[model samples]
Target: MNRQTLLGYVYAATGAALFSTKAIFIKLAYMERVDAPLMLALRMATSLPFFLGAVIWVVWKAKRDGKPLPPRRLWISAILAGCLGYYLSSLLDFEGLIYITAQLERLVLYTYPVMVLVIGWMFFGGRITWMSVLGSAVTYAGLLLVFLKALPEGGHDVVIGTVLVLGCALTFAIYQLLAKKFITVMGSLLFTGVALSASAVACIIHYIVVSGGVDFSASHRFYWLAFGCGIFATVLPSFLVNAGLSRVTAQSNAMISSISPIVTISLAVAVLGESFTIFDAIGSAMVIAGIAIFAVADQKRAPAKRETLPVEIEAA
Candidate 1:
């Protein structure tokens, strides 16, 4: 590979690995008795300023280039997309993690691309080849293995958690589909900055309204965890992934990101003392393999049909 390509791989892998740590930090914070809203709020609070800075920078650059500003409608759409993807989807994921292992959560959320494909086919006249179906089936079969294995151990909570995470995946898929146009017009960086900042504000408002006040009474460790989530997991990985995209093909970036769930599984085992059974092993492998197949098929899709669709889902 050329130097740029090599650097792209490094950036993508590092970003994926870092983003994978989000669940571990979240699980640890939960051990300290932090609720989902507060945790989400704190994380958004911590990350808000950086995203705001990005927004300012993008605006300045746009003006410097004599580009017209995005319309109010596009800004609203971006904000809505951010709220759906980061705020709602993340809230569900966080809540689900309370009941399910991080490994399981990651695996379940990994199916969002499949969800996107299905949604596209259903509503947007997108074609579904046999390869996509096979890949999706295999992916779900693997998830079933993991779910069945954990069902006995976690019982009702596992079911509930799985459902919640499913909701997260679905919402995120919708967000990806709907946000494409806004991302195109406003540019990814600007749209992302505006959306994420709006989501952060929404999260803070939700926390205050739900809890009757914003509580910052958590332990120091919780603060550190929040910082890790906000900066390392959320903000840093975003830029790293964007950087990787600049240097590498989207296909290569997707392949590199396949390591994400594996990284999360390893961290959960090491840090959270979660078990890794034969079922978990086989199931995780299947999930990754299935997604790989799906990604390949997606890339092979008609270029015209692919124009309106996003290639990958954003990380939580």
Candidate 2:
């Protein structure tokens, strides 16, 4: 590979690894007696200023280039998309994590690409090939393998957590679908700034409504973890992945991101003391393999179509 391509792969892999740490951070915070709403609020509040600064930078750059800003309607739509993907989806994922292992959560969320394909084929006139179908089936089967093993010990919590994470994956897929046009029009930097800012604001409002006010009584470790989640997992990884996307094809980026689940599982076992069994080994492999197959097939199927930057991957 050329220098630029190698750099892109490094950026993509690094971003994916950072993204994998989000679940670990969330789980760590939960161990500090932090509730989902409070943790989500803190994470987003910490991230808000960075995204707002990005917005300012984007606007200033556009003006310097004599380019007009996107339409007001697009701004509204981008905010709505952000709320769906980050606010609602993240809330569900956080709540779900309370009941499940981070490894399971990451594995489950790994199926979002399949959900994206199915949603597109069903509602957006996108085509699905037999390979895609086979891939999706294999992916779910692997999820079932891991999920079923969790049931006897985890009981109802596993089911609830799986459902919630699945919801997160679905909403995230929808966000990806909707945000494509906005990204195409507004550009990734501007759209991301607007959307993330909107989501952060929504998270703050939700926190106030749910908790009556922002509680700052948490341990220092909690704050540090939240800061790490916001800066490392949320913000830095975003620009890194976007930079990678600029230098590489979307297909290559997607393929490189397959490392995400593995990273999460490793962190879960090492940091959280979660168990990793032979079933987890087999199941995780299947999920990764299935996603790889699906992603390759989906990309080949629409080789001529315009590729939308998968910016949503970094939002996790």
Candidate 3:
């Protein structure tokens, strides 16, 4: 791989590693009976201060350089991105985790890429290649295996959890695609700041509505961990991924970042003492293989096609 590609791979790998810690932290907080909305509110509240600081610094630097501030349209986009992408998506994810195994939860959540592709095809006239179809099939087959295994052991809650996780995945996918539209105009720091702030506001509202009031004293440790999760897993990884995307193709980034599931499952098994059955292993492998195939096929089909015209020809 070229230097830029290598850099992107490193950044993406870092993001994936950080992201893998999300489930572990959530599980830690959940063990204390911290409601999902409360935990989410704490996370966003903690991260908001840091995100705002970054925004201030960025804006000041731009002004120092005599650059114009991002326009109102970009800010509006940022608010929507934050509310839906950060707040709603994360709330659903944590809520879903309450009902599913950590591994299963991660597996379902990672389906965002598939959702992105499908949404693109439906909304933007993008073509869905045969390989994408096959990859999606394989991925879903893996998910089905896990679902079937859980159904017998988990009873009714398993189905509910699965549906919740699927919703989380869909919402997250929408966040990604919609955020892309504003990234260029607002830039990453500004976009993230606005979105995260908006998400924080939404989370606060949800927490109040669900619990009747904010209860900060319920679990100090849980809140602290949730705050750490927001920083380490959410903000830091997001920054890394955005930086990486600037240097590499989405396919390469996706392939490297797919390691997140492996990390999450391993942590679940080792730290959480959760057992990984044979079927789980097989299904996980299938999911990884499907993602690999999808990324490789996409790269092959869209190989960096760049052309340069002669100066004389360009004048015409």
Candidate 4:
């Protein structure tokens, strides 16, 4: 591979690893009894300035190049993508985290690749091949094993958490579908910047409406955790992966990102003192296997009419 491609792979892998840390930080924030809305608000609030700065720069660059401003429709897409991808999905994930282990949460959330495939087939009239179907089946079978095993110990919490995170994955898949178009039109940086800005605004508004207002007197430790998540998990990894994706194929990015669940699971076990198990190993293997299968299936499928989902994976 060329240096640029190799660098892209490295960047993608590193960003994915960083994205895996997002859950860990959020889980840490929750340990402080920070409400899900409040935590999300803090994260988005902390990151908003950065996104705003980037948006301004993008617009300035466009003006310098004498390019027209992005249309209103594009802005609308950004807003919707932000709300669907980050604000709502994040809120659901956080709520679920309150009830479940981070390991399970990561594994569940990692299924978005599959979600993308299925949702595309269902909504967009995209064709699904047997390989993709089998890949998804293997993935879910592993998920079922891990999930069922989780059930015996956590009981209702596991089910509730799984449903919530599943909601997160589903909604994010929707965002990916929607934003893919916006990205093509607006470019990754502009689309991502605008979407993040809108998501931050939505997060702030949602928090106010739902919780009445922010509690400024919360523990400083929580702020640190939220800040870490805002930068390390949200902003940094996102742009990093976006940059890397610009240099590499989506397949390469996806394959590199497949390591994220393992990263999250290992971190959860080592840092959070979560238990590790044979079932966890088996299930995680299956999830990875499924993703590998999906990637291969995607590659082998007829390409002329595939309607082009980008190789760009979300670092959100």
| Top candidate, metric TM-score | 2
lDDT of 2 by residue, 1-316 (tens): 8998789889988988999999999999999975888888889999999989999999998899999999999999999999998898988898889999999999999999999999998998888899999899989999999999999999999999999999999999999988888898998888898998998899889988988876656899999998899998899888888888888878888889899999999999999999999999999999999999988886787673324374654364
| Cα TM-score per model | 0.95, 0.97, 0.91, 0.95
lDDT of each: 0.85, 0.88, 0.76, 0.82
Best-fitting candidate, scored by lDDT? 2
Q: For residues 35-95, write the lDDT of model 3, one tens digit per residue.
A: 8887777777777787788788889999999999988878887888677776777777888
TM-score of 1: 0.95
After superposing all C-alphas onto the true structure, candidate 3 shows an RMSD in angstroms of 7.0
Q: Which residue pairs overlap in candidate 2's backbone?
A: none
Model 4 regions more than 4 Å off: 302-316
Against the correct fold, how does model 2 do in TM-score? 0.97
Higher-TM-score candidate of 1 and 4: 1
- Better model by lDDT: candidate 2 vs candidate 3: 2
Candidate 4 worst ten-residue window by lDDT = 304-313
- What does the lDDT read for residue 270 in candidate 3? 92
How many residue pairs clash in model 3? 1
lDDT of 1 by residue, 1-316 (tens): 8998799789889888888898999999999975888888889998899889999999998899998999999998888888888888888888898999999999999898899899988986678989989999999999999999999999999999999999999999888888877877888788878878888998889889999875667888988998889988888888888778778767667678899999999999999999999999999999999999888887777331212222233345
Candidate 4 pairs with clashing backbones: 250-311
